[model samples]
Target chain A: MSVSLDPVNIADKLSLIDELWTQRKIAGLNDYEIKLAKLKGEFVWHTHPETDELFVVVSGRLTIRLREGDVVLGPGELYVVPRGVEHCPVAEEETAVMLVEPVGTLNTGDTGGPMTRAAEPL
Target chain B: MSVSLDPVNIADKLSLIDELWTQRKIAGLNDYEIKLAKLKGEFVWHTHPETDELFVVVSGRLTIRLREGDVVLGPGELYVVPRGVEHCPVAEEETAVMLVEPVGTLNTGDTGGPMTRAAEPL
Candidate 1:
């Protein structure tokens, strides 16, 4: 497959996304995928047994709740939820986030449920 | 090694970097690493034969010159340079960027020289 050489404007992509908690793949580096998601309220508590998940808040605030404590993030802040660690992402208002994870990694992770959805290209 | 659950503020880390073109590791996701770099002027033309390199502009603008064409990126923009493609990053003014690539991927890629430096933690 041919890789496009165009730059992806994060804000533009995020504006096109209307669904909350749905990840849209923007780019790929090696086997990992860079995804953008609009998040609100709360996400399911889950763990990825095989890989770490990186969350970068693009707009608004995000609180990553772990068993130990909550890692609150604002715009331009990032947090990594380590492998096998349960994390639930919560946001009071609408938040734009960029996520980096391995290809095929689930959004709901090991605790797949109604919120689980496969990522599609934006 | 224990992973810290603290949120890494991208602007805060960028403020700590003094030298241009130097990369500092901020977080790790599986075998890949997330890095922050301050860049200005031109970088050496290089290619990562083994992996693709991702660049996200946090502040200012960046131009990734590939053999095919130039990809201009402004703040909140990103582009992925495919593996084996020669690329040279240039910024007219000081730019803060976030990079995602495999662990041990060099700043200079296959063309290591005076511009090459090992990434240290931020």
Candidate 2:
């Protein structure tokens, strides 16, 4: 490496996996975290009232659905869901991505449904 | 999309580019932000005194250099550079990544050397 660093390189952490629904915690502050989430197929619909989430698709394709419509995020693209907004995430095929938000975040926002929470902290 | 969404999908935002040195703001709290930074080549040497930055390598390869040694962050790998730590980041080839830090973060931290600040807010 020739360039001098600031103190961290979070992008390096996201390369750990290439599968769907994989959550890898790369870095965080007291209230927020940077995570790598891989996705395939479809996920349950949910929302968060306390904080907004930032999703960046590093590879493959990604889409987010709101109550009214859906937004598609591709490589080098991003979307912000304001707090308390209900939305769903689904990938037609295998997709790799990164997530930044607070810690202890519930997958389904405040409403816990059948597929709301994630079991592991990869 | 089948999974319930919190307020954001940062990975979806990252998919907006594939070039090097492209900085895109995905989301942020009052003081922090989730960014998708496209990087290549070697960056300047610098450090920050008040904040620690997280870099997650989503594609290609990434490496962080400190005065003592260098830590390489491959895809899916993560490293935390404590505040006031001096380091450098370099990629032998083009790499895609996600960065999480504060809103007014300096690329070279407080030291401010050549290549310390970014000109754009992508």
Candidate 3:
């Protein structure tokens, strides 16, 4: 069966996520986790050993940092962070994003730190 | 690193998908494919025994038909068709959709037909 949601009209959902840090699970599979998150400020550093993570910019600007370089992603741009790569995602302003990761994956991965934003949806 | 795409401001991307029949794979994992598609008219009757397919309308409306009942999904609506369920998606007017399904999936599944839409991107 088919149903759809216009990504352009998800204000309410975004507002909901603003007060929370969880990546709301929209739909996903064993290979990836598709989630929507509201983010701002500097996020923790982490890596995933099981799967590559992708971020698609929908609104606002998102900055991704690696040891070598940093990418500034705007709306309509996408970035792929291969598995086992260390990186950090930060936003100077409020930004909304869609995250795709594998199931049973950890947001923090092997770097178990206090800043690891690892938790299920609230 | 982090990137995000706001679901509410995806008009340009939707327009790009117009006049197209393929599910434009945006991002994915080993188990699923996330795609954006522009659709009108009746799609094939098919089933996926390996995964539950989800349809989210980003704009316009969508309809899903099952052997028993059909569901009419609006812009904010979502529907998940369980695996092994025979179903068809039909649209009478221009519609945009976001699809979540497993990778290497057959849109028509076991009973392939001319109506089955299978192809890589153009």
lDDT tens string, model 1, A29-87?
88889999999998999989999999999999999999888999999999989999988
Error of 1 at A61 (Å): 0.8
Question: B1-122, model 1: which lDDT tens digit per residue?
Answer: 45476899998888899989999999888888999999999999999999999999999999999877889999999999999999899999999999999989999999999999999998
Best candidate, TM-score: 1
Per lDDT, what order, best first?
A: 1, 2, 3
- Model 1 stretches with alpha carbons more than 4 Å out: A1-3, B1-3
Better of 1 and 2 by DockQ: 1
Give the best candidate by lDDT. Answer: 1
| Candidate 2: tens digits of C-alpha lDDT, residues B15-70 | 66665565676565545766677678988778778887777676778888888788
Tens-place lDDT per residue, model 2, A80-107, is: 6767778788899778776777787866
Model 3 chain B lowest lDDT segment of ten: B1-10
Worst 10 residues of 1 chain A by lDDT: A1-10
Q: State residue B36's C-alpha deviation in candidate 2, in Å.
A: 5.0
> Estimated TM-score per prediction?
0.97, 0.68, 0.75
Please provide, for model 3 over B1-122, each residue's C-alpha lDDT reduced to its tens digit, 9 standing for 90 to 100.
Answer: 33332222345556666454467766654445667788788887887877777776766788888887777877755566777778888888878877767776766777677645653542
Instruction: Sort candidate 3 into its docking category.
Output: incorrect
